[model samples]
Target: MKLNVKKFENQLLQRLRDLKISNKKVLLAVSTGVDSMVLLSGMLKLSKVLDVEINVAYIDHQLREQSKEETKFIKEFCFARNIPLYVYRWEKEEHPVQSIEAAAREVRYNFFEKVLKENNIEYLVTAHHGDDQAETFLMKLIRGGNIQQLQAIQSVRIFREDYQIVRPMLIFNKKEIYDYAKQLGIKYYEDETNKSDDYQRNRLRHHIIPVLKAENPEFLKHVLEYTQQLTNNLQAIQEVADVKLNKISKEETLDYNKFVKESPLWQRILLERYLEVKGLEIKETQVQQILAMLNDEKKPQAKFDLNEKFEFYHEYLKIGIRIKSTTSLNLEENFELKLNQWHNLEEGKKIGLFKINEIELMPGDETLVVEDNENWVIRHRQPGDSLKMSFGNQKIKKVFIDKKIPSEQRNKSWLITKNKNEVYWILETKKTDLSLAPQNAKIHYILVFRKK
Candidate 1:
């Protein structure tokens, strides 16, 4: 079913008007596809009436030399229309980070974010139609995530700390986009991969979803309606879950005894809610751990090594987190050991000379000790930084992996350094680690966490 240009144009204009996106500079992440090209031209047609200035960009993924053709296509189209085009180039070696598609997408968005800082760009416009939304929902569903993961992408998202993202064509179906592009004589380059199951999203679009559509032609409409309704209730769900979970968590700590006693729905909700606060994803396995800990006879403990950043600790009736550094200490950056330090350390920092002094505290009490440790300093991670634990020598990196720390929090963790070896107090990062006696004296120095 082909759509007339005026109809699609009207819909686009209505979206822009509803969003109230400022009529300043809008950056289009153009891929030279039919969807994006059509969106670009529609924005162009609406610009005069809406008072919006537009900039079009084609991100050359450089996955293949053929991708360069997309750059050429978008460049030519923009040149013919007197629209400025920004092209970002990426070589294979430039992104030795992830798979080509993932790497390319990251680099491209990074390009846009960089451009945002330089130019007065107000919003980023994209051409993800109704079909794309359905595809995304299906993907999240298959992955077995809860409501937060399955929430539909917003048509107008506030992405930046200050700026925004606008998707004006979100309500339009792909058929409408295709027809409008054709009727407008818009030229676009179709990457053959889009039609193949080369990517998971494409696989769903090409293989899985078509069968479902054959069964229910109105699947997208129904799903969209359901999502609209869900959005209305999402915040309420979050609020109830937040309040109930906070109640059971008991001072931001999960008491498994109480957690297990709640209804299954509340338990799951609490688990999901707490994990979000702790910066951990509540995967099915992790959820199982929560259940097991709740049912245990004594205080239970479980740790997840989430990307070498932070450790998820759910034991002894509470959930605490620990972040371990992956490399040897970097002295340039200020690294402070929270539980290991001296009396009124002035600044909350680690690694400074202190005259040997005697301090006394119980095994479970907080003690601030100051001593002259020649090799100790607060620093960033370095290569070959090892900790000699009771389990023999192990790389802090390996410890991080075995511990299931989240990746984003790793570098933020401070280290206690002594000579070349790291003084890994409290199992790299633990709620509590044993502090050594001051200057080889008999007095045991223990800094307990402040009791709430």
Candidate 2:
């Protein structure tokens, strides 16, 4: 069934009017692409009938030569209607060639945003139709998404917030939309990409969906309707969850017993809310895993490392988050590394109460190394240090080369220091060491970066 203009216009006008955006200037995204061209035509019709004007903007991604011609046609079409046209030619230079499609889309949208900002355009309208919505739903399902991500495209998106993205034809199917465009004698540019089966969307449209629809003719329509209903239910569930969440939830932690008592649906909602607040989230399986620990004897360790920065722990039926574990020499600022003050290291717990005796070139078992006499900080080798090699007291750096340890690793290495100087040198001066020193009389220190 064809979509009546009055009905379509009424639906759009109602939404825009409710939001007080009916007569505002809209920057129509016209790629001479089918959907966009339909939108441009619809808006042009609307301008005459509804007393408004729309500025047409075409973005040439410049990936193909056809885009130049497509953009030119769109400009000409707009000119015929006396509609103001803006053409932005984007190149690999403007939008780097990496992930061409994604780059192109980003640049195109950014171009629209820029135009909207500069020209004081109120709304950025696009020609995303029902097929687009269906394809998006399919794409999201194929890739992955939670309930929210499944509804990939919103009917009305907020571009600037003040300038809304109003999709007038979201409810119309592709066949009807194309028929509408043809019936109105609106000329549109066709891109070969749309028909190519190489792209996932086209493959789904050309191959997967057709076969599926043959099995169940009304599958797309049913799914679209189901998705719409799902969206409504999702919104309602979210509202109820929000109310319960405010009443029952606590920051950094939750009452495990109380969370367990809630319905499974509510539990899912609370978990989502909790994860979102903590900047952390997990799969349904992980959520179930967390839930399963509620009745377990051993305090099960259920942890979620979010963005690898914050880590959440669910132990003893308690939920809490903390910073990630990093394995790096938490070095001092600039070139002021204090080797003497390294006694407080948790890593060196065994070498408790160790102190620096002397750090110097000495005739030792291994030649040179950094060991804790008490609990001194003997980190990795430094670049500029000169030490006696294990073999014949040669330059310790020569041993490093023989050891095949990278120069970078040697910068913060665990080199043995003795009394801040050799025992003989220290004995001669009787001077207390200022930095990394010999802790033990005889010990071989190898780079045990991590015990594991």
Candidate 3:
């Protein structure tokens, strides 16, 4: 089939327009392959019409003897066109067992990311066409991947916080890519490894995809549509999950009862999102295992080790890193309770005492009044510290036990006192309304805690 250069150029322009990359610096990942060469050719043509700046990058995997020659050819090609070219050579590492394809991809991307940061490149472009997407989908599907994974390649994806990877040629098929390259008279070296059936993708491309295409010439088009639909559905489901999760999530815990009441599919989704926010990863089986632990009636207060770094307590579904207790505040020797100012506490926590009239108090925040001549000190709990509660005078140790504050945390907990006789405020736990002020008290203090 003859390539319609005008049609291909129009398509390329439309894709770039949709990506909103008209004036952006794009680093194109090019191999001496037909797909990449055609992409380079198309971009060169678009450069005349658009304001986009393009640079080429090539990674020599060092797996083939001809890789050196292919790298030289790409360097010369870019030089002839007056385009900047970056070349990275892979360094092999000794591992007991490794997938060469996966290892090569990791090394190539690490280099690309480093270059992007060094040069302030906004977009990393690759020539992943429709056939590559289909092969990826089929491989992940056969390997029992979830819906999101089955969708495979995306047109544009965030590579880092502000950088993106774009596949503008994903709208084209392999045959169209070859035709376009041929029509432009672009020279590209073929990778013999691509034709070898040692890799699963190669086996699919050489053996399975042809038979499927023979049965239905438009099989790939349908697959692309199906994957798009799956992507849309996954996005919608994620939106709903996010809304529900936000409603029941707290700073350090998930509402266990509400999370358990959700449907199984939503439970999985919510857990996945929660873990993602925590910067943790859990497999499907681990998710199920956690749910089972939550549902187990015999162990109402069970604790599960998520990994070396984290632990999950069942009753409240609190997931947090298992960190050592902070050292004692040692307030007896060094610290004093300063009024009307914030004090820096251990562990990025801050405490402030203000007059109730000085700041509007939120609900659940405690307020109190103190005598003018009273002296106060901020200190960690002592052996016999007691707080005057609504019920009566209660030992601070009893309060910690009743609230189920971890033993490690209790050792580091802070307390405020007007005298050595009574504890008035326990930071982050509760404050005692010690009605010890004069009838017309002139000084009121509000103790507040905040994270830095």
Candidate 4:
């Protein structure tokens, strides 16, 4: 087939202009594959016409034996064309045992980031075409997610604060890229692993995508058109969602009572935007978990672990995402219990010992009522301390073990005690018989714990 060389070059040149990457120092992430080779060749041609500064970055992952040959070819190609090249060889010893593909990608991007920063490049150009976008869209669709996940492979996005990553080749399909490279006599190496069905993408590429294309000749074009449309729609939705979120959200906290009034779709959009602003990826399960926690009428307060470092929590009318604190609270150390005052603890935790005549409690407030003991002290678990339960005196250690409280958390959990070594309340985890105030008791105390 005869290739429309000028048409392809013009389209790429226009894309560069549209992304505003023309006449700027841009680094090309090349892999000596057809798609990237076409990108490199096209950019070299455009550099002369548009006065764009071209630099090449190639990560020799060293996973395949052909990497050595590819590296030599790229070196000679760059030298002959008078283009600057940056190459890094990822040693086999450094490769991970599992998820090697993802790990290699991380390493490759890290290297590209280093090169871009050291060389002061403004844009990192990549060769992700329309076919890749279609595959990614289908993959995420099968996996299930919100619209943001369905919309794949952005043509231009922020790589960091100032630098941007641009994919001009996204305007073309995979076959167009290969044909362009062939017509221009651009030397490229094919990755054999791309044909293997061991990877999901490869499986799609070999079996599913071809079948889809066979059914509809313009599948890639339609996919690209839909992707762009989705991108535009998301921008509009995000603008509206941002406004809605700002009204109900304060810092990391959201007024969930007000948030629940919005439509379910809007709620999802708002939550997705909220996490995006906080730089957290929202998984489908996480979104459902958070929504269930927020909407559950029975459970006034609940928490879901988003990851090891972060958590989503709903308390009364408020819900929010926060970083999980690693602070260890010493239960053995006692603090002077001040009456009628909220004592601040580590990680925005608060405890109060208030003298009250009537029992009044709010949702999410863990309270324990006991006979007024002027000598009450606030502390965590201690040796030989036991909770006075209905059946018998249960060891504080045994209570924690029975409750299945994690050891790390058992040490950090707070407890209210009086008369030394008598555990009155195990905070939110449990309430002992000692928590009940005597019927004729003149004085009563309510120990409350809250997370701000």
Candidate 5:
């Protein structure tokens, strides 16, 4: 088959232009395969027409003995053409191998990121064509992925704030790439592992794609078209979801009530977007666990441990980094509180005793009058300390459980007391009539807590 090198070159150049990477320095991930070789050829030709700097990057997994010969061939090819080449070899023995494909991909991309940063390259180029996209779609579908995951591969993906990965040949199919390489007489090495069915992708490529292509000659073309449509639709949905998410999301917490009212699809999209913003990639089970926690009316005060780095709680669906309370103040040590002065209680927290006549009360602010001339001490909950309520004396731990305070917060919560015999007020919530001011007291003192 005759290859349209000019047409291919124009299409690739147009893709790079569309992605706004036409004149940027791009590092090509070349594996000496037909697809990569064709990509490299097109990029080399494009360099002649445009002011784009193209560099080749190759990673040898070292799984097969033939990789050494392939590396030698790639080096010789790049040397003859005077193309800059960066080669990385996998230290198989140094790293423990588990899940060969996943491990290789992780290592390969890490190397790519390092090369991109060290070389000041903005774009890392790869030769993932339409067939790869189709195969990925099928794989995700069989693996129970959602709509977003089904449209996984994009033409251009922002790898980091300053770097991106671009696939310029996704418009072409595998057959077109192979024919282009053959017609141009490009030297390339075929990986023997690709023919084996050890990997799911290999199975799909060898068995499923061939059967589907035989049934419909333009199967890959149709799949690519559908993927494009799906991508557009998902983008539109995400825009709407973002608007909803922004409405309920604050600096530290998301309003659970508003989030729960959204449609199930919007809820999933919003939650996924939230996690993505936090740089977390959660599994479907974990997403479901979060949704379950949100929807559980019986356990509205539940907390989900997302990972070691973060925790999700149901108090307005607060998602934040896991923080353990370091300051555990024991009430055994009594500390005096002076009137009209603020005292540091813990990090970002303080308490003050003020004359009620000097300050106005806000709607949400809690105030308690000083009962007698005795000195008040600020301390955390002790074993015997309980809040004096309308019904009876309730244990501090029970009060915390009733108020649905998270355990981590309960540990650091403070209490106000005139003596060990009675508890006057809890820092944020509970209060007793013991400190309530008389109907017409001449002087009133107020206990207040402030958080920075």
Candidate 6:
């Protein structure tokens, strides 16, 4: 297929302008492969025109014999053009036994992020073209997922706070990229694994895509259009869902009273949004199960486990999510307490300790005046741990029994401590008498605990 070079360049320029990437140093994630090399060539050509600085990042996975040669080629290419290039090698020892693809992706992105942060670059560009987008949509559709999953291979997305990932090649297809590379006499490596049908994506790319393309020459174009439309519609729906979810959500709980009154569609959306906010991935079957449990009047107090890590419960007028507890506690594990930073004690629980120069005490706030910052740590309850009382130290075990705390709850309780066998606070349950005292000292240190 002959690619329209002028049209491709115009689209690429417009995409960058649309992303507002002018006068910025953008990092190109290149693998010395056809698509990425084409992107590198195009970006280098436009760098002067757009007033942009181009930097290249390459990851040598070291899985194939050509890996070293590819790395060398990328270095020589950048050197000849006097462009900056960053390269990272995936050492053989670091590779996992299974799920290597997911692991490689994670490693690749981590390297990209590190390079971006260290160099103070705000834009990371990649070469994900229209054909890849279509393939992703088909894979997700075949595997079965929510609408969000079907809106695949976004052209632009936030990589992190204040940093964006831009894909300028999404308007082009693989054939166009290959054609462009050939026209420019670009030298690139072919990953042998891509031709293998062992992977699902490879199977689809090898068999399904070509058949569809032959059946309808515009298959890629139509699929891209459908993806964009789905994304647009989902964005509109998400806006409404976000507003309603904000009104009804408090931390991890949704006001059951307000939630039930929403239309059934809105109710499902709200539930889905809640799960999304909690970073939990649920299947359609699981969503239906949860909806059924929530709508059951007889089971006002019921719990549903989405997976091993998380579960949600309904109690009268509120729905709450919590981390599922393990069969046994590992009390020996301890986390360090750092001032002015939030320490995650466990899933859904964190504590922040801060030191302030001037102190205005909120009546019920937890404050402690410390002479020195040392030895503070957070850990699960240990056997024979005690809290000092006016007369003597009392065993935490006795306190739990006296307070009628469930055995499971007692096992999961986290405590703040500075010394062995002494508990300062039993986090959200018991506070040391010291923590309750007013901030009358010269300096005030406040400790705040949050459960989400």
**Candidate 1: tens digits of C-alpha lDDT, residues 1-70:** 5566777688788878998844678888898888888888888888988898888767776765578777
Query: What total of clashing residue pairs does each candidate reach?
Result: 20, 33, 0, 0, 0, 0
Candidate 5 differs from the real structure by a C-alpha RMSD in angstroms, to one decimal, of 5.1
- For TM-score, candidate 2 versus 3, the one ahead is 3
Deviation from native of the Cα of residue 317 in model 6, angstroms: 1.4
Model 3: weakest 10-residue lDDT segment is 316-325
Candidate whose TM-score is highest: 5
Q: Relative to the unseen true structure, what is the C-alpha lDDT of residue 217 in candidate 5, on a scale of 0 to 100?
A: 85
Ranking the candidates on TM-score from highest down gives 5, 4, 6, 3, 1, 2
Tens digits of per-residue lDDT for model 5 on 9-108?
7888888788776667889999989999988988788786667888989998888888999999999989998888999999878565567777888889
lDDT, candidate 3, 1-452, per-residue tens: 58788998899999888988688888999988898888888898888677889998899887888988998899889999899999988754532256777777887888888889889898999999889988998899787734568888888888866789998887888888888877778888888889888889999998988898899988888887887788888789889888998888777778777877888878778877777767776566777788788777665455666776576665434433344324444545425656677778768777666776786656554445566434666778888888878788899888886786765567678787776557888878878865656678767555666665
The residue pairs found clashing in candidate 3 are none
Ranking by lDDT: 4, 6, 5, 3, 1, 2
lDDT by candidate, in order shown = 0.66, 0.61, 0.78, 0.83, 0.80, 0.83
Model 3 C-alpha lDDT versus the unseen true structure: 0.78
TM-score of structure candidate 1: 0.66
TM-score for each model: 0.66, 0.62, 0.71, 0.74, 0.79, 0.73
Against the true structure, candidate 5 reaches a TM-score of 0.79
- Residue by residue across 229-249, what tens digits does model 2's lDDT show? 887887797788778766665
Per-model RMSD to reference: 11.1, 12.6, 7.3, 8.7, 5.1, 11.1
Q: After superposition, how far is residue 405 of candidate 3 from its true place, in Å?
A: 4.2
| Model 4 accuracy (lDDT, Cα) | 0.83
Model 1 stretches astray by more than 4 angstroms: 22-24, 80-82, 95-98, 158-162, 243-264, 295-297, 300-307, 314-317, 324-452
lDDT of 6 by residue, 1-452 (tens): 57778888888988888988799988999998899999999888888888999999999999999898888899999999999999998999999999999999999999999999999999999999988988898899999978899888887888966789998888888988998888889899999999999999999999999999999989988888888888899889889999998898877688888988988898899889888877788899999998889888776567889898888887667887888766666779787777777787667667767776543434455545554455677888887799766666778988876675655567789888875456777876776665433556665566667665
Q: Alpha-carbon error at 371 in model 3, in Å?
A: 28
Off by over 4 Å in 4: 325-452
